[model samples]
Target: MMSSTFLVMRERVVAAIMSNPVVGPDSAGTLARMNDPSQNCTFEELGFDSLARMEFCIFLETEFGISLSSGEIEASPSINAMAAYLAGEG
Candidate 1:
């Protein structure tokens, strides 16, 4: 069973991914996959280029008020992983 905090963080992470201009609102297919909690989508699978990766990291740092490096984000690599890590950091 998942905790409420982790669930909230997961939703926030998905929301951030959707809202990022780099991800673009037009990628509806990828967005849908991301919304499904059962799926484990990697940033690379979502077509997150280097620039988008940096933008995502910046968005996360600003949104969550936590310092995060690309290395840390890379270590996480999926919505669930990122959310779980951030839940602890938050």
Candidate 2:
């Protein structure tokens, strides 16, 4: 089971992605991106790409006040999985 806090973070992450013009408000499109084998999602697919990865970390830190490793973030491919990981349930 995931902690309520982590669940909230996942919601925030989804909101963040949706805020991106490229992503927009289409839940289906975001889900497709998550399921794309070529992208393989992970955290790296959060549009981090190396340079942006650090920025993403910073964003998470500033937004959620939680310090997460790139590897930790990358290990989770789906929002639910990420939430579970963040919640320390996985």
Candidate 3:
């Protein structure tokens, strides 16, 4: 089972993905699938191109007060990876 903290973080990431007009609701599922730390589904698999990743960084900054460096995002290419990065676990 995933930790509650990770689940909470996942929900936040899902909400961020769903709220973005540029991303559809289906994107949330893709985000969720890619969020697994064990999976290598990657941001690219969830349709997060470079521009989308930048926008996601902005969203994370605005929503979670987490400012991710470009290198951080590049290294952690999934929602859980990003969450871990933001939570100082990466």
Q: Which stretches of model 3 miss by more than 4 angstroms?
A: 21-41
Q: Where is model 1 more than 4 Å wrong at Cα?
A: 24-29
Tell me the whole-model lDDT of each prediction, alpha carbons only.
0.75, 0.56, 0.63
Residue 58 lDDT (model 3): 79
Lowest lDDT sum, 10 consecutive residues, model 1, at: 23-32
Itemize residue pairs with steric clashes in candidate 1. Answer: none
RMSD of 2: 5.6
Candidate 2, residue 8: Cα displacement in angstroms equals: 1.1
lDDT, model 1: 0.75
Per-residue alpha-carbon lDDT of model 3 for 32-51, expressed as tens digits?
46555454345556666666
Writing each residue's lDDT as its tens digit, candidate 1 over 18-54 gives: 7778874346676777777766577767667767778
TM-score of each: 0.78, 0.56, 0.65
Candidate 2 local lDDT, 1-90, one digit each (tens): 446776576666555454443323235665676443332234544544554445555666777787877676567755666666666776
Worst 10 residues of 2 by lDDT: 35-44
| Alpha-carbon RMSD, candidate 3 | 3.5
